[model samples]
Target chain A: MRTYGNSASVVVLLAWLLLPFATARAESIVLASTTSLDNSGLLGRILPAFTAKTGIEVRVVAQGTGQALATAARGDADLVLVHDPEAEAAFMAAGHGKTRVEIAWNDFLFVGPQSDRTAIGGMTDAVAALRLVSEAGAIFVSRGDNSGTDALEKRLWRAAGIVPAGQPWYRDIGGGMGAALNMAAALDGVTLTDRGTWLSFANRRGLVELVHGDARLINRYRVIELDSVRHAGAKLGPAHVLAAWLAGAEGQAAIGAFVLGGEVLFHPGVREIPPGE
Target chain B: MEEFVPIVLRSLAVSLAATGFAIAIGLPLAAALALGRWPGRPIVVVMVNALLGLPPVVVGLVLYLLLSRQGALGVLGWLFTPGAMVLAQTVLATPIVAALAHRAIEGRWRRYGPTMQAAGASRWRALPHLVRMAARGVATAVLAGFGRTVSEVGAVLVVGGNIAGFTRTMTTTITLETSKGNLDLALGIGLVLIGISVAVSATVLVLAGERR
Candidate 1:
């Protein structure tokens, strides 16, 4: 009995001793980001070095792009790393964000079971591919979380002139990119996902990329600092610093070098890269 | 419907495993706190009770830090797995079990302690009999733990990553679907989660009635 008491106290003491070191210090800034980027292993690759070099600790909160932007709007976070271009524009137009700077780019891909049940492979036109998949009544899983990928999928469906909501073949999983990918792998359904998450996903379960390289499939990530002058108490200084860092040479190089499973998942400001380069 | 099978089964398995571990460890801790005489016992009891309200996200965050790639226990690599879900659930459940089981056992201990002491029986000797006498209470404690873990999302979502056919339990699925605006799917899963809790309560009642 005495032994158990002593051991319990020791365990509790150890926990208390370690608690302070586990959390970021007072100098840290919260950076809200999309789950796709966080789960893609990009932030983990870059943030440690970012913190090490600049002594500006970035505490990342990975939510969907919509949620991340919402966090910034609420003044809960200093900066937002998000990919929903439409939402980013809306945020800036609404006078919530100071500016949006392109940091990196990745394309979305239509991936599915290796069997290619929809036969939409080799298709470069995203809308046409989606139209064919819808016409065929093939299974298409959706993340349904109103994420950047979800928003893109909705736009594609609209472009294809289809409302896939009630279709038996259309399933909404309502999860993040990885969860949707796992569902696609499990159910042998087709789903659209960001290239970064697709590259990091491990449980392929025979899933393969079927369609990509469409102009509409391009995914652009941006860093936005809140307009702190309007929204008082916003951490404007660190947000600007981090945003500049991400758009600068070192951040671009870090993004260019990030690889998973031997594949470079994102191109740093891909629009800036010349055709020959 | 077929897709939901794995989700429901996984939820049950993880919550059940969590409850099992909670009971295994909690009962002894509850017994120790209830039966043993110590100076700091009141403080220990208060701490355990306070832990019953431990935020699920904090539990998830702690476990996540302890299990991430850069975490101290990252070598196990259990993050984003069903194993991680179970571990997080266990953390959430253990305190509930300990606090509730202590309440249940303490009453019985008070009644049995003096009698045993008069009979020249050691404090430890009364534990088994007291536990048996307090079986219904312990069962309630187990149910409480199960109830908390079965429908929890925050901790499991953080640790489990909510992957399909791996870590996507009913609660996590509901949370995801709700955020995605898939109310139909979310409602369906929500009903199933409620159904599970009802079924558990029914079974517990039936067994208790039979014992009576």
Candidate 2:
């Protein structure tokens, strides 16, 4: 018993000794971002450049775009990098964001099993492809997580004039892009995923891109700083620096230069301002 | 693997600190429940035992709100930090430690109570003696608490935000790497986590054997 007591005390002492190392840090900013960007390894490739140049370490909390916006709305993050334009507009209009700037752009792709049961291969129109899948009752794995890709998928379904909620073929898996893709592979179903995450994803399990090159498939990423007036503790200085750096020449170059397996994932450009900006 | 060292060390530090805090708060509560004559002792015991099954994600959500900038405790700016992660883990671990320690200490208290009372020792006064006598059982309880915290990913993921090089732990890193489709790295981290659990359990068993 005495030996046990001594061991417990030693463990507790070591814990106390290492506690400070876990908490101490220099200048840093919390950036709530979408899982697609993080899964694509874009941030992993480009964030170090921003940190090295500005000496401000970026701690990214990757979630769905909806969750990322919600996190920033609650003042839990200094800034946000997400691709959901409608949700971003709602967040800014609700007075949660100080500034919003488009940083980079990617497009969503419809991917599924290589067998092409629905024969959506080489389809350029997403709405038409989705309608064909719905009519054929083919397995469709929906992200169902309120992510940017999920939002776009829902919009395409609406445009197709099909309500797929209660359909037996629509498998709504409330998960991330990669999870949705894995599910699609397992069930031999189809799912919508961004170009970035799809390119970097390794567990394809015989899944292949089936549909792309639609104008409606464009996914634009934006960086937004939290409103300092509402969130008094918001790290506006570093947030502003990071946001500006992302839209600046150096950051744009970094985004464009990030390539995976000989393919550029994202295009760096602010083609147009957000609605009501 | 070099990058993983810091993640593993941070996970150990965070979980250990939370377990230490839980033990600090739990042992006394356990002794009180086991030995003291209180009006609401049964209710307190039931509550603690029930809390043993508290969902970690709910705890994380509650702590996230309390620590958010818009919430009441926002002044501390602990959200998305290691401090918040520790608090969430402590909340998760305290009930396990207290309830299990209560069972261990209660048995020793019943066996040693009459002698201590005959020697004119109060219930509070006998706490240390009872705890020492029940050290092996209490150590087991502490190990259980440590194991729970070390293996938990839900609460830490929600509260710590899984920041790289900061709040990321072994379990959270596994979750992140899996989502990123880095199956090799994720499995490697998972193996390390299991190895740590095995090592700690073996150490405790060896110590218990020494007592015999």
Q: Whose lDDT is greatest here? A: 2
Per-residue alpha-carbon lDDT of candidate 1 for residues A171-263, written as tens digits (9 for 90 to 100):
998777877877788789999988888776666777899999999999988787778675566667877787887888998999999987788
List clashing residue pairs in candidate 2: none
| Candidate 2 docking classification | medium
Worst 10 residues of 2 chain A by lDDT: A16-25
> Looking at model 1 chain B, which ten-residue stretch has the lowest summed lDDT?
B175-184
Model 2 spans with C-alpha error above 4 angstroms: A1-26, A271-277, B208-212
In angstroms, the error of model 1 at A113 is: 2.1
Query: What DockQ does predicted model 2 obtain?
Result: 0.51
lDDT of 1 at A167: 92
- Over B35-139, each residue of candidate 1 has an lDDT whose tens digit, in order, gives 888899999899999998999999998997787645687667566666788789888899899999899899988887788889988888878878778878887
lDDT of 2 by residue, A93-159 (tens): 9988877888999899999989997899999999999998998899999999999999999999999
